[model samples]
Target: MTLPTSYRAYKSNADGYQNLQLTQVDLREPKPLEAVVRVHAVSLQFRDLLVAKGDYGLPTGAGIVPCSDMAGTIVALGEDARRFFSVGERVCANFAPDFLAGEPTPENRAALGGERDGVLAEYVVVPAYSLVRVPEHLSFVEGATLPCAALTAWNALTGSTPIKGGDTVLVLGTGGVSIFALQFAAASGATVILTSSSDAKLALGRKLGAHYTINYKTTPEWDEEVKKITNGRGVDHVVEVGGLGTIERSVNAVRLAGSVHLIGTVSKGASGIPLIPAILRSIKLNGVVVGSVRQFEDMNRFIEARGLRPVVDRTFPFERAREAYKYQDAQGFVGKVVIEVVEE
Candidate 1:
């Protein structure tokens, strides 16, 4: 395949996320250990929205490409890349390229869509080791949702305390991470209890294998409902994405020594959890920031072996990327919001 000399990219400026603009620039060839991918699709996450709004804490000087999760066919590969990956394989970039297997370090925390150039473009060059092969059964759109959201959910379930069969898991909300958590936990032979304000979405969760669902809007003390569903033993795991506003309840909802995987701050600031219950219950509050490249590979193997399909609520064309962000911000999505960068 002949590589284009230049390509179009979306850049977010100081003006705001809504002020994103498309610009054409020269596409550089990859280094010896790198690969150039022609992006097919990219998925939006809450962090992407934060970066676009210039509120992600990472520096976004001048402008920055604004999405981390992408799936594409590798168009070009350098000499060393041939050892691990091929020129035509479908793959996704790891969000944190530097952290491949172990505990994350400050250096490894530099992420796509923030400190580095992202894949909201025609092509993206990343380290050869940063690429994870997509499952054979998944479409590019489904593969695109795996890097951040799916992997975060994977890490949450299997990170600190691996979820066991028959254990009860609680996922908050029907967003990408929570939905993935629900699917993964259920597939692992666990009973999943998911909470969403919308009964419609909760019904969707049941279809996705959730054993029980709670309408948090109606059940303000939804944690009590969770406990009731679990026969007062509390759930064995909680995928806590609601941050401060629901952390207290998440603590109350988990069983003794159960794990609470803290994955997001969707609730902004809603006060802190009392450590006394956490201390007394010996609950594990595991903070998950996506996962390592090694974990991505592990997840892909599991996904492919099990034929797990990512739930993508809607897709938009590349030109409507800003609309995709706004739609995600509107928070009506049942799963993931993806932007199709190229046709299948």
Candidate 2:
């Protein structure tokens, strides 16, 4: 196949999402260990919004393409790249490309969309080693949702002291990570209690395998509701995506010595957890930053084996990528929002 000499990609400007532009640029040859992917679909995350607005707690390089998660077909491979991956393979690039496995170090924590140019493009060159094959049962759009949100959920459930049958899980919302957590925990034979302000989303969560749902808007003290649902023993794991705003309640919702996987800070309010209660209960607070490439591969295997499908709330054409960002920022969607680059 003949590779294109150039392609179009969206680049964020200093003015933020409103100023984002689709530009045509020359494509460069990949390094010996890299391959060029023709991006089929890209998915938005809360972090993508933060990066576009220059509020991600990191410096955004001028003209950086924004979006971490993408599914694409490898259209070209550099010399020696064939040992790991071949042209025409469907794959997704890991968010943190360098962190292949094990605990994350500062040196290995460089991520796409924030630390580097990301996948909101017609084509992208990435290290072959950092790419994972998409599951046979998933579409490019579904595969696009995995690199960040799905991997974080996978790490939360199957990480330190993995959840098992008879365990109970409490997920904070119906966002990408939380919904994936609910699905994963339920698939692992653990009961799930999902919280969302919208009763409609809660109903959808039930259909997605949440054993119980709480409308946090109606039940402000949803932690107590979790306790009541768990017979006052609390749950085995709390997928805490609410950060400072909900960590205290998450700590309260977990059983003694249970784990609280801290994944995001999308909510607002006073900062700080209930230190005394957390200490007394011996709750494990594990901070999740997606996962490694190895974990991504492992998660894909499980997803294929269980036939789990990602919940994509909406999809936009490549020309309407900015609108996709706005739609995700609205926070009404139950799962991921996608931008179709190649429109497979």
Candidate 3:
């Protein structure tokens, strides 16, 4: 295989995440077990924002492409990679690179966009085992958002959550993961109670099948509202993104034997958990770190068969990748933010 220098959008330095430029990069010839992707689109996650700030502790150089979620068509294959993912197939690169079909391993845990290079570049070489076929009906923009937020949502929801149809779920905020969880829970026939700081966002959550919405900014004691919404029974599960500021309240909002999917925090560090409430309720708290390849495939199948659409708050041209991160930071969009790499 011949190596060609490809143009990629990269931040000049870790602190320059908001400032990026296109530069020519030579892609290494794929190993027999690798696939090289011609990236079509990438999505912005909080981790990408952190990478710009030098927070993710990833391997980086000046002008690194910073992102985790990407969807693209395969263009190159290693000598022995043909049996895995075929060239020309649309797929999303997996975060858990080495996890095959079931349980995770230490190596599978390294993940792209972290210890190794990630999907921010226009062309990325990934272990062929890590590719999950994107749903045929999903747009590139929507599919790009799934590798991170959607998979994390699916992992957190299915990890230990016992909620079934008729069970109520409490989702905090209207960010990417929460919104995906809200939509997915609804798809499973579970009722969802969505809370947001914005009334407009709350209305939009309702439009996405949330049975109820709470303005946590105005209604600070939203757990009480949760009780009211569930007719005093409390919710069956809470997708705990509110972190230190809201975890205890999240515990307060769940019924006995309920589960909490501890996902994210816009907070500085760990969230405060009220151990007494947790002890009394016996609420199960599970940590979610995206998902394995099998989980992603299952999610794609469900989304495609049900005609589910992953929300795209906005898109930025690949050339404007830096500006896209800045815009995503400034705007608390109801869903995912993306960048389209028009050329590979």
Candidate 4:
């Protein structure tokens, strides 16, 4: 297949995202190990907002694209690519391509959409090695949300501490990561306690598997509620997305030796935790920054087998891609928000 003259890309900032069109430059044809993907959909994440605003890392240089998650169909492949994927197979690129299994490497760090042009485009070429075959029954939009949020929850729950039957798991918030954590932990036979700001969304969370929920805005001391719900022993695992704002809350709600999967920041810019209390609980805090290709594959299998429906908050056309970013920023979403891209 021949490359085109140009493609579409988007950029973001704290204010929001903006779309841009560019001529396709000569793309390196798949070398022996890479695959060129025709991007079909891109998913929004909070980090994308930070990257766009120039608050995250090294400047993206000029004309850098935004977004880290994408689902697409493989259009071409390098020589050895057939071992893992085939042309036309649906695929999603891993977010932290460098942090494969245990440690991070310099090369994988230059992953798509960070210091590099991400998938907020009509077409983007990724390392053939970075692709994970999307589940046959999944759509591009659903698959797009997997590489980041879903895999992060999976790695946190399974990689560090596998949820056992009857284990009590506490999830904070109705955000994508926390929602995924609730579902994944529930599937593992753990009773789930979720915290959200809205009672309506909390109702939906219960229908999705949350055995209990707290309106954190109403009860600032929701962690105490966590203990009360767990009968004073506290939950066995806590998906701590609140960072410093709720870290102490999470620490207080976890049982002795319980594990805490530190994933996000509901309260950005500052983190305050009662260290002495946290230390006394002998709790475990594992910093989560998404997961590996192996973890992605495992997550896909679980999602497919369980018929897990990722509650999509909404879908926006490519023209409304910036609106999608703003929608994500407004935090009016209950689940993942996706942007659908089309071939020009």
Encode model 2's per-residue lDDT on 1-344: one tens digit a residue. Answer: 88889999899865678789999989989989999999999999999988888888878789998899999999989898989888889999999989999999998888998889999999999999999999999999999999999999999899887889999999999999998999999998999999999999999999999999999999999999999999999999999999889998899989999999999998997969888998998989898899999999999999999999999999999999989989999999999999999777
Candidate ranking (lDDT, best to worst): 2, 1, 3, 4
TM-score, cand. 4:
0.93
**Model 2 weakest 10-residue run by lDDT:** 10-19
Instruction: Provide the overall lDDT of each model, using Cα atoms, as 2-decimal numbers.
Output: 0.92, 0.93, 0.83, 0.81
Worst 10 residues of 1 by lDDT: 54-63
Model 4 gets an lDDT of 0.81
- Comparing 3 with 4 on TM-score, the higher-scoring candidate is 3
Off by over 4 Å in 3: 1-3, 57-64, 267-271
Clashing pairs in 3: 11-63, 12-63, 244-271, 244-272
RMSD of each: 1.0, 0.9, 2.3, 2.3
lDDT of 3 at 36: 87
Residue-wise lDDT of candidate 4 within 1-344, one digit each (tens)?
Answer: 56665666564433336534333454557788778888898888877877766677556655677778999989888888878787889899899655566655665556556677788878777777677888878788888888888888888889777888899999988878888998998888899998888999999999999888889889889988888887899998888887867787788899998898888876753657667877887888888878888778888999889888777899998888767877888997898999889522
Tens-place lDDT per residue, model 1, 78-126, is: 8888999989999999998777998899979888988887889989989
Q: Residue 72, candidate 1: how far off, in angstroms?
A: 0.3
C-alpha RMSD between model 4 and the true structure: 2.3
How does model 3 score by TM-score? 0.93
Please give the clash total of every predicted structure, in order. 0, 0, 4, 8
TM-score of every model versus the real structure:
0.98, 0.98, 0.93, 0.93
Q: Model 2 off-target regions past 4 Å?
A: none
